[model samples]
Target chain A: MTLSPTERSTIRRGAARARTDRADLHAILDAGLVCHLGVQIDGSPRVLPTAYGRDGDTLYAHGSTGARSLREAAEEPAVCVAVTLVDGIVYARSLFHHSVNYRSAVIHARARAVTDPDETWRALQVITDHLAPGSWEHARHPNRKELAATAVIAVDLGEASVKVRDGGAVDEPEDVEAATAWAGVLPLRWSWGEPEPAPDLPPGAEVPRHVRGRGVR
Target chain B: MTLSPTERSTIRRGAARARTDRADLHAILDAGLVCHLGVQIDGSPRVLPTAYGRDGDTLYAHGSTGARSLREAAEEPAVCVAVTLVDGIVYARSLFHHSVNYRSAVIHARARAVTDPDETWRALQVITDHLAPGSWEHARHPNRKELAATAVIAVDLGEASVKVRDGGAVDEPEDVEAATAWAGVLPLRWSWGEPEPAPDLPPGAEVPRHVRGRGVR
Candidate 1:
């Protein structure tokens, strides 16, 4: 299935870089841990970086009930959620062509506040599992009070655009032929470092296999 | 000098995590490579990840003149720029306490379109240098056409907020004492991989020391 890009979701600036495949959108969203949520507040636009999770075609973002951005998002006519993953820095012979090889997804929707208990519980698990792969099963579930204090907002992925630039620098023919400057890509590598056990943990507690197995990519 | 948080800049939900130090704001902004630019378009909020640079108390963001977000930001009364650096993933005995160790700065300001030639040139250099430490000097400078095709916007950092969370999980006393689940932090390590020279580069062209010396932290 292809993404049904609405007028707002269409990419006009770099139209060639926009991807229409639904799988591309899902891949970009799944790889990101945090998304910048944009919502109108007091007649101005505000963006906040918050944790998020994806379940099929719906993206879930949760925050404390007191968060003004979340509250405003729930009430706003539409909100924008953008997830960007910078894969590498593209170096061109000319400074004007310097760019970052990245995959970015921007979704526009009227986010619905999730109030159903069962859905909230599932959304919380999806969020936890996204951040820490196995934590949802190992960690204690959210208590009643904790659940009540959190606000979950769901954004549909139907109206979204995914743009990706993965290739090396695209420089002018003259600059490429001159070749006076070095041009290439410096890939950005993200990995999980050695786990630092909680300071108050009992002495002999070992880092679980789930954590240890999350080796460097 | 401490950051003078305006009514909107004041972080209400995570009050304790809100930082008042001016140095903290600069540090977080300098450490990030990309920032999420938020602006209202057609009465709806839109967020896009874009390149930015800082000069003292001002932040400059630039994009192609054809970009809609930049045009709207220049006309809007206010826009929010958010930079976030995730340091680690915090795991807690309880899902409710799980968090991310991050340093984030959000600036709210009226972005001014940079029209002065000299200021635009300097801003472009600042932005280029920020992304590729020494590229401004090594690469060919932008000519008249390139300069005219770019749109630069400057935002004052007078009204901003910085929030940081660096420690381990803060779990309930009961969960900590119970010790049924492993609790700790998985630091997110970002590094520069081996530079892949451009395929079109002359065979003998060597990677510059400035690019090679960007070693893993």
Candidate 2:
């Protein structure tokens, strides 16, 4: 469908991607395991892909204490969290006109370090499980010493917007036939492959049902 | 291999896979066609993904004069360019330890608007063709009116870093066997699918060989 400027977040050039909505936001977030943490470090901007978890309007991210991004976010006033899923490659007649149809959300807000031990402990679980469904329950819990060395930051989802692009390419009617260049989309997607067992596992550790059966969303 | 603090950037409680570097950076950027352009908007952060081109040490981005991001970047002192590529799922024995290995590049730099018509025209061609490989030659050249409304921004590529993680899950030796969870990476990759011709094309418009046989970089 044709998207107008008004529908696309008040930004004239950005298409609102009318087919997408808020629930699409949740599915995109939940279906993926990583996000790029965009923050300014020492006045320079950086985008780092890290593990993230979302609980309603707030999203939590954590990393090593010594990491530059985590340290900066903990001390800074705010940061931007961007999550994107490239659904397909939208190829057009002209090379200059190629684009990707995708679903993405950018969240801009203040982030604060979780200093309370109880909160940090809980946040870590959310983060771990966000990465894998049952891994948190099966893995070793963090000890006091290990917990003390980590940096965890939480950002509310107040100032955010989702931009998505889907469907076949939209070519100008006038140029349709004269456009001799093959003008269509080459769809792109990611999917799970056969499971590979860990090298150190005993010879016959059968693949867990939940993981072996897991498919890309 | 286990990455040490000195080798990979660290976060306090973040996982080992979160640490990434230069190889990861370029791979991510080259794998995709566009990136999120983050600039200060209304005294806060605004991010919009637009078409971009990379020439070794410099990044070029351009859009219609009607596009707000180009206009804002032209006026702002600095902007952030980020490219992120998610390769595949890294499923580990413990849910808490599950991660996605990716490559990302974040550039923090001052941006300059290309006011010269000659430069603007060429940059537009670069940006256009970057999106569509051979389109510049096929599409109608921009008329003076169209040219008058275009905006181009140049970002110097310096002081940027690339981080990446690849291969299998790293788990404690003891948990290796007891970890009943299926533990191996589902190798992920991006490739071009068969092209779909524009529905409006003439009855016998042959797909250009350059566009048809090309593989996604």
Candidate 3:
């Protein structure tokens, strides 16, 4: 299914960078670990970065029960969530043409506070799996008190937009003809380094294969 | 100078993670390539990722003149900007303790639309230098038409809060005593890859030393 852009979700500026395919939206959301949530509080807009997870078309975000942003998001009429990944820096022959190659997804929806016990449990697991591939089974689940202290909010990905810019810089014809300056892309690389064990762990506690073999692009 | 957190800038949840040092805020902003701008449009919050630059205590963000978010931010009473850098993933023996090591700065201010020509030129250079360390002097500067087509806004760093989370997971004593599960951190590494020259560049156009030696953490 393709995305049906609403009046507010449609991309206006740089329309060529917008993607309508639902798969593109899903790909951007799945690859990101954190999302910046925009919500209105006291008639002012506030943005906060928080962990997020995706299950099909619904996006899940959680925070402490006392987080004002999450609380406002649940009560507010609408909220915006943005996930961005910087792929590279596009260096052009002219300053005006310089840009960043990136993939970003923005969702606009009315956030619903997840209070259903079963759904909350599933959402938490989805979040854990998103952050650490196989930690749900390996780690001890949240106890009753812990669960009560957390707040989960779900927003549908129905009204969303995805934008992607890749490859080298797009410079002006005149600038390219001059050839006096170098122009290209400086690729940004993200990787997972060696895992450092917690200080309290006993000696020789094996690092799980799930984390050791996990690949980050 | 220390950050004097205002009523809205003060962090309530996880107050321990909040840093009062202005240097911490500057470091987080300097290390980031993009920032999420939050603005209220039509009584709903909108969050968009955009390139930004910092000159001392002033934060500048620019976009096309026709951009609606930038327009709203200039007209709105208040806006929030957030820059976040994820350092690593903190894996804990219990799901409740799982967290992310990150440095984030959130700024709340009334964005002033830059109308002065001199300030606009300076802001553009600051943004260019922030994205491509040495591109301002190497590349052709923005012409009059290019300058006219851009919109720049400046927001002070006066009402800002910085939050940082580093090191390993903080888990319960009971979970540590059990010691059945592996717990630690998976460091996230960011680096700049070899430059990919633009397709239109002539053969043997040397890459500048500034571009070659630029380091990203």
Candidate 4:
């Protein structure tokens, strides 16, 4: 299903770079490990990085119940969650044409404060599995008290927009032909390195296949 | 000088992870490639990933002059600039303890619209140097019309907060001893791949040393 762009979600200047494919949005979100969440504090805006997980069409962000920002986000104005994967820095023959090649998904919605125990448990599991894949099955799950202190905010994906800029920069007619400038893309890549074991691990501890495979990334 | 945290900039939840050193904030900001800029639109929050440049304690974000968000930010309530680097994914013996090792800097302030020609040129140079080093010197500089079409927003770094989380996950003593879970941190690394030249490039054009050396990273 494609995302329905609202009047607010439309790309004003660079309309060609905007995407409507829901799958593309999900791909960008899944490829990214962190998201910047925006919550209004008082009359101003505050943006912070946090971990997020998606289950079907719903996105989840959790923090300690005592978090002031999270509490404000759940109660008042709608929050914004943005996940961006920068592919490369585009160099054009002309300075005005230079841009970054990126895939970005932006969602605007008021996240529901998850209160039901079952939903909260499910959301945590989804978040855990999203951030660390094998650990949910391998590690101990959250108990009663742990759940009590955590707050989960669930935002529907209905109101969202995806913008992507790929390939080489577009330069003007004269500059494109006249200049001998080195113009292209410097691709950026994200890779997972070897897992470093905790300092307190006992002797003969094994690096599980989950860590070895770099699952869920 | 260190950052003077206001009531909003104070880290209420993870005080241990918050750093007041202004140098730390600059370092975190310098190392990041993209920042999520948040601006409130019509009472709802909107967050989008944008490229930025830092000169001294001032950060600059540029966009099309016709951009609505940029105009609003220059006129109304303050904007938030957040840069986050995911260092690693921490897996603990217990699921609740799972977390990510990251360094993030968030700045909250009003952004001024730069209209002066000299300041706009300087701001563009700072931004270009930050994204692709040596390009400002290599490529043709912006002409009159190009500068007129671009809008630059300058934000101060006074009311900023830096939160860093590193090392292994902290699991409960009982869970660590009893559970046989593989606990460790899966490190994430970002690197530049070989530069891909523009499709319209001449046959024998050379890749500049700046690109070869991965400058400004």
Order of the predicted models by lDDT, top scorer first: 3, 1, 4, 2
**Looking at model 4 chain B, which ten-residue stretch has the lowest summed lDDT?**
B208-217
lDDT by residue (B128-203, candidate 4, tens digit) is 9898888888888899898888999999999999999998879899977885787889998878888999888888
- Cα lDDT over the full model 2: 0.67
TM-score of model 4's chain A, to 2 decimals?
Answer: 0.96
The alpha-carbon RMSD over the true interface for every model, in angstroms, is 0.8, 3.2, 0.8, 1.1
Candidate 1: segments with Cα more than 4 A from true spot = A215-217, B215-217
User: Chain B alone, TM-score of each model?
Assistant: 0.97, 0.83, 0.98, 0.97
Please give, for residues A37-149, the per-residue lDDT of candidate 2 as tens digits. 76666555556667888776678898777777777876777677777777666666543345677877777778888899887877888887676656566556665666876
The ten-residue window of minimal lDDT in model 2 chain A covers: A1-10
Better of 3 and 4 by DockQ: 3
Task: Tell me how far the alpha carbon of residue A202 in candidate 4 is from the true structure, in angstroms, after superposition.
Answer: 1.9
* lDDT measured at residue A161 in model 3 versus the true structure, 0 to 100: 84
Per-model lDDT:
0.91, 0.67, 0.92, 0.87
Query: Tens-digit lDDT track for model 1 on B113-178?
Result: 999999999999889878888898899899999998999999999999899998899999999888
lDDT of 4 by residue, A26-144 (tens): 88878888888898888889896888889989999899999988788888658899999888889888777888999989998887899998899889988887888877899988888
Instruction: Evaluate candidate 4 and give its CAPRI docking class based on DockQ.
Output: high
Off by over 4 Å in 2: A1-10, A15-21, A94-97, A116-122, A177-179, B1-28, B94-97, B137-141, B177-182, B204-207
Candidate 4 wrongly placed segments (more than 4 Å): A215-217, B215-217
Best by TM-score: 3
Winner by DockQ between candidate 4 and candidate 1: 1
User: What is the Å distance of residue B63 in model 2 from its true position?
Assistant: 2.4
**Model 1, A16-118: lDDT tens per residue?**
9999999999999889989999999999899989999999999999999988789889998999999999898888899999999999999989999999989
DockQ of each: 0.88, 0.41, 0.91, 0.84
